[model samples]
Target: MALKTYHGSCHCGAIRYEADIDLTQGAGKCNCTYCLKARAWTTFMKPEAFRVIAGEDHAVSYHKHDQAPVKFHCPTCGVHVYGRGDADYMGGPFVSVFVATLDDATPEELAATPVRFSDGLHNNWQNPPAITGYL
Candidate 1:
């Protein structure tokens, strides 16, 4: 799919944001503690492609023990929206957006988009299992 801008927000409508995403590239399904609990379908994009349109102050961030990928969520509804990390985790510096927060993304679209499982539980980015599935 071609790159497209997608609008999203937290559960209570706070923390509105937009991101330029290409669903044809697929998403990451990580097995880390946070990812496992949140169960979010994530797609990465450059910071320039992401913008906080409104209610940014209403969003809260949680950092894991490693302080990588600070997870952002809405304080009012406690919904995980997206995350960012300074280091290069998946190719280069990127902002990870949760597809579930996307306002216009359909379930069929999500299912059609591919998924790659990441062994984040062990921090093994080099070679994860080849098992594929959808969120």
Candidate 2:
């Protein structure tokens, strides 16, 4: 697999980060409560492959009850850029970045990226939702 360096930020530019992602490996689309609300189109990578390039002080983490994925967004822009997973089921130590936040990816790059759907809404993350049209 080949890793591509990507740079991204929140809507208002309050938070900036860089990540190394292997888009050919595929991304994820989930129907979880939070992801649904945010319309998250995301890709996962090792935490070591991602870093906050700026505005760390402006970062705000949003935890959903006892969920393992801690979503981090820009406090100023309220844009969810990425999340850190700590649960084994989530493949611990992973960073899930919202592809929409990727500022440097070309339209062609995103269009060509493969995606997998997940049924997070039903707590069945290992499998895709029955109807993926909404997700």
Candidate 2, residue 14: Cα displacement in angstroms equals 1.2
- Global CA lDDT of candidate 1, please? 0.82
The residue pairs in collision within model 1 are none
lDDT of each: 0.82, 0.89
Best by TM-score: 2
lDDT of 1 by residue, 18-119 (tens): 999998888888776788789877988888899999987878889966646888998889989989876655666689999889998878878888887877
Summing lDDT over every window of 10 consecutive residues in candidate 2, give the lowest-scoring window. 84-93
User: Which residue pairs overlap in candidate 2's backbone?
Assistant: none
Q: Local error of candidate 1 at 122, Å?
A: 0.4
Please give, for residues 42-135, the per-residue lDDT of candidate 2 as tens digits: 9998889999999887889888677648889987778989988877876777899999999999898899899899899988888999898888
Error of 2 at 81 (Å): 0.6
Count clashing pairs, candidate 2.
0
